[model samples]
Target chain A: MAAAARVFSEKGFGGASLEDVANEVGMLKGSLYNYIKSKEDLLFAVVRPDADELLMKARRLSGTDLPASEKLRQIARVHVEIIDRKLPYVSVYVQEIAGRGISQEWTDMDREYMSLIEKAFMEGVEAGIFADDLDVRVATRCFIGSLNWMTRWYEPGDPVRARAVADQLADVFLAGALARSRN
Target chain B: MAAAARVFSEKGFGGASLEDVANEVGMLKGSLYNYIKSKEDLLFAVVRPDADELLMKARRLSGTDLPASEKLRQIARVHVEIIDRKLPYVSVYVQEIAGRGISQEWTDMDREYMSLIEKAFMEGVEAGIFADDLDVRVATRCFIGSLNWMTRWYEPGDPVRARAVADQLADVFLAGALARSRN
Candidate 1:
């Protein structure tokens, strides 16, 4: 699957072929069929587990006992870490190539992930950590935008560098979302 | 050029042809040849002036006498309005299609724009309006990322809504960048 993911990432979903995946795996095309039915299935294989893991980790972050600011910081850190750890796979997932039509799963996962971030903002609001009238939806959207846009520019992934970026993002976003009195 | 921009936006630069541009203008391809030698020329025509105008406006904003927060607010407002006003043209410029290979102009324009935003951050730092030790480059990149990411989700352009979004973004971003004492 890592082989397939790399192939898809390097060649793009539309441009990648079953042979390319097989080549990456050092296996012949005919033998590779035993593991996957088709390229769409390969794409599903590539993206689904990662999304599931990301969603799971987010749930854990939301349910943690930490303060809202700390949680947001950790969330940003983990988010960037995973993005770097998974590297090009996240790149392909965000791109959502023509085969994005193959299923609605990606769209559903995206919405769920977004709402989880909103949940963090809401919790902060309830705790008096963020502004009472904070536009949680807009704030979360912009927050996510700032992080996700990194995918466009952050090629040649380095886990340490990504961690630093994560810290910087969290610091700024927390400032942006803080209760007026807290600042 | 409006017709050509629309055609390029709709068909995509690589997928689009001279015939498509000519047809978009309701003319024969042969007649279109009198104006543009090639598709690359048309792309240059469409993008250069919009970019030049955007840069000119950014320069004016950098020279403003407004406080940092208000300046940032108006910058965000004007940024969103232009993206909305220009709609798919900004979209195309960001995408940097195959024809993007034709020149380094887009890359340079993008760098210049980024630096302009950084200048805004520096001015705030110098005014002691933002944290003296703030990571200006990171802050500016994140700020621009927040706005540019809007283009991905903000498909239906409405000036009023774009303005509202601008205000929200600016408000939050200023909150993020404000000095500790100010808060």
Candidate 2:
């Protein structure tokens, strides 16, 4: 999967072939077909673990007894950590997920990920832990957007920046753009 | 340009050739080369206008005497309005900008757009208008990402929703996720 991810990231999904993944992994092209039927399958397999990891961790966090705010803070950190660690896989995932040949599971997993955050926002608002006027869907997206945007600028091997982003973004999301006290 | 943008957006910069753009704009493929040298040029031409519009508007806003926070409030609105209005061109820009054949100006304009926001964030902090401890780059990117992320889900012809996003996001950026009063 790591080999396939590097191939796809370097060549793009459309440009990559089964042979490239085979070359990357030192397998015969025919042998590659035994495990993956097509390049899209290879692409899917490469991207799925990262996506699944995010969803799985999000589910575990949601299942916790922690408050919505704390859940989101941890969610933000986990999200940054995974993306920081899996830049190549996540890059291909972000670029190719919108194309048609990708599985419906991609869309489902993405929606569920956002839905988890949306639920947290609703819970926060309901518990008077967040602003009552907050549009849960909008807030959820904006928060996710802030974290996911890191993919554009974040470099791998820079755990410190990623950690700062997680903590700072969590702070920004929690405290918002609003100043703590007016000067 | 509209025709070119539609062709590029539909067929993609790589998939679409000079002939497709020429046909969309009702020109001879040979003649089209007289006006536009390559498919990449056509893309740069189409995407450039929207990019220019955003930069132009941001430059205009920055010249105003408004406080940095107020300037950002308007910047948020303008960014949303432009993206909502020019979804197709913007979509193509976001998707294709990183590919090799695209122009350098694409990256430059994008950086300038963000630099404007970064400057505002810096001014806000330096002038005691924003939190002193704010990570300007992170905050600026987070704010811009919240706006840019709208591209993934924002459907065209939804002015009401666009306005709501602009206002809500601006508020969120300014007010932040912090509660005004903790329970």
> DockQ numbers for every candidate?
0.34, 0.50
lDDT at B101 for candidate 1?
Answer: 31
Which regions of candidate 1 deviate over 4 angstroms?
Answer: A1-44, A97-103, A155-157, A177-183, B1-46, B97-103, B177-183
Those runs of model 2 whose alpha carbons end farther than 4 Å from true positions after fitting are A15-34, A98-102, B10-34, B98-103
Give each candidate's fraction of reference contacts reproduced: 0.39, 0.51
Model 2 interface DockQ: 0.50
The prediction achieving the highest lDDT against the true structure is 2
Supply the TM-score of chain A against the true chain A for every candidate structure.
0.83, 0.88
Task: Give the Cα-based TM-score of candidate 2 against the true structure.
Answer: 0.89
RMSD of 1: 4.5
What's the lDDT for all of these models?
Answer: 0.73, 0.79
Deviation in Å, model 1, residue B148 alpha carbon: 1.3
